[model samples]
Target chain A: MDRKKNISMAVIKRLPKYHRYLMELLKNDVDRISSKELSEKIGFTASQIRQDLNCFGDFGQQGYGYNVKELYNQISAILGLQKDYNYVIIGAGNLGQALANYTRFDKLGFNLKGIFDANPKLVGIRIRDIEIADIDEMENFLKSNPVDIGMLCVPQTSAQKVCDILVNGGVKGIWNFAPIDLTAPEDVIIENVHLSESLLTLVYLLNEGK
Target chain B: MDRKKNISMAVIKRLPKYHRYLMELLKNDVDRISSKELSEKIGFTASQIRQDLNCFGDFGQQGYGYNVKELYNQISAILGLQKDYNYVIIGAGNLGQALANYTRFDKLGFNLKGIFDANPKLVGIRIRDIEIADIDEMENFLKSNPVDIGMLCVPQTSAQKVCDILVNGGVKGIWNFAPIDLTAPEDVIIENVHLSESLLTLVYLLNEGK
Candidate 1:
């Protein structure tokens, strides 16, 4: 497979959606699907699907369409899910605890190695058998454990500080839930799950016609 | 104060971000900001900021820049934060409970009216004085209470079913955390927070150069 260079961010964003739909098809034991059929399920246009798949590699055949299992594996590889990621949650608050308990990430090869919190009451609690450590210990913990991803669930005031610790401690990726956007080096990737922004967007759209 | 006709989705998506930055300026007692200053803070170009704000109304005078409080208030109104939205969470698992306990939404004028879960273990448990009810009772509850938004944190298999019930009961918006893309009527707005896809995006970026 000849790898394509400089895939657009729009195409990168769609890769996960492709991965998701392909996974669903695999679950239902669907052996093959045409771009038109996949488009109907995924809500992207058929041409858009063909174009997106072509960014990573030639996926679908002209007459035979796409082999479901093959497409799924290709997207999975494109999404970098072929390997496991060791991670840590920086805050053990309601959101952090919830994310810690979410088993879906585990299924997708994200392994949670530690959970840290500043709250004394929460610091000793065990979630999924990984005892919550004091936030103060996170720097040393990350030094020894060597995390690939750091999940930021801390409050906004402390988010940057926590993020700095993660970056200095060698974590390359940040899955931020904190409301504030933390600054990071160019090599580090930050993906924000801004819940407030998302809700406000929904509210704005719900009232768009009015 | 004539609003621009047909604001693009790209501009609409950036509104919440502008709202957030403007609110921060207000918090710091900063009364005015140039587009360049805001651009530095927000990571968008000065021209881009001006273009986005222009979608809703004329903001920012040449040289005088923008009045922080006024811009904040206008963006708040534009984002529909002026009115309170009564909402229900349809699954009381980890993510649902995390969102329920997320007090930031409450501060932004989203009121939690009820919480519903199919799990008997979570039923009747009170989160911020609002008790979780039987998931089966949600349809009847919405009939009497009339929520504006439904937060779907349920499993993939049940998300669409739960979404349909909310829509049928007259809910106009959905803040979805489930992994699946849900179907709703044209008028009903759906905003998704796909955590798995987000994590995958980060993983893909982290490994992009490898």
Candidate 2:
């Protein structure tokens, strides 16, 4: 967990993207990969892939390249995905419900622990093995058995308030899709997942492509 | 837009992030800034900010600092935020509806044009002055009225189908909020806003902070 030594944040961010690309290769039964092949799959340069990978260890052999399964395992371990991450969704609307039922996460080592909503009617509702709990009781529940992360699905106005509550409720991390830039203390990190920004970037790329 | 500029994708990706930080400075009435100040505010090194801004032009003075308002306008124009970008949400579910009413877009010049959904019950319904249209009518609608960007908010099972429909409907860009990735041609940029990846990063940061 030493922040300075493990890898740069930039290198760490690319691991998941590379992992996704490598999983596609593995699915096609491709067992060996060169830095060039890894870079091509991810739109990064071969040297850049070598450099990013070298931060951890020598993933690719000189002539033999990389063993796909071995490389994938190393990446998963680096990303802390070797073990499951238990999480709770803070809203129960379509977005939250969709996240709770999302099958894509099962393969990625994420477990939906439970869902929390302020609505009384939605509380006591069940999804998979987890039941939706009232938001009022969250602090007490969290104190007893705290989850590793909280997925924010609340409205924009409620985003910061919910984040503050989540931090106080013993939640260590957040997956915020709320499109709000939360200011947390240096210790608590808030990464924004803005759908609008992504759309805007794609538009710029398309505009440039033409 | 020149692909041979040797610009790190990390820096390219941060353009929007940079824009957001600048907007924050403007909102707080900070009229002047420096590379060092901007670096501190945005959590980048001064050298990194100088290098990133060097790609476009020198917006800073020799000894004095950067004129915040001028630099903000320059960055905005470079990012293509000078004109309002009209974008449509392709699904009228809770996620899309919530996005249509979101306030974060005002600062970034995003105008939510309308919403489209496959459900008959949702069609013709109005939210925030934009009527929900049937997916079957999207092609004709796009031809008559063009939108610069399309956001895919449908279920994961139907994400690829909807993306294909949008591409065939003449959309050159897509922002996929669904868990699954959509396959688009190389020329057409498809940004995968992988919801879990953001969470994973936050979790890793929190663990390290501890």
Q: Considering every candidate listed, which one attains the maximal TM-score?
A: 1
- Colliding residue pairs in candidate 1: none
Residue A7 local lDDT, model 1: 81
Docking quality (DockQ) for each candidate: 0.75, 0.37
- Model 2 spans with C-alpha error above 4 angstroms: A1-5, A21-74, A91-98, A117-136, A154-161, A178-189, A206-210, B1-8, B34-37, B60-66, B119-126, B129-131, B155-161, B178-187, B202-210
DockQ of candidate model 2: 0.37
TM-score of each: 0.97, 0.76
**lDDT (CA) for every model shown?**
0.90, 0.76
Q: Using alpha carbons, what is the TM-score of model 1?
A: 0.97
Q: List the residue pairs that clash in candidate 2.
A: none
lDDT for residue B23 in candidate 2, whole number 0-100: 72
Candidate 2: residue A15 lDDT (0-100): 68
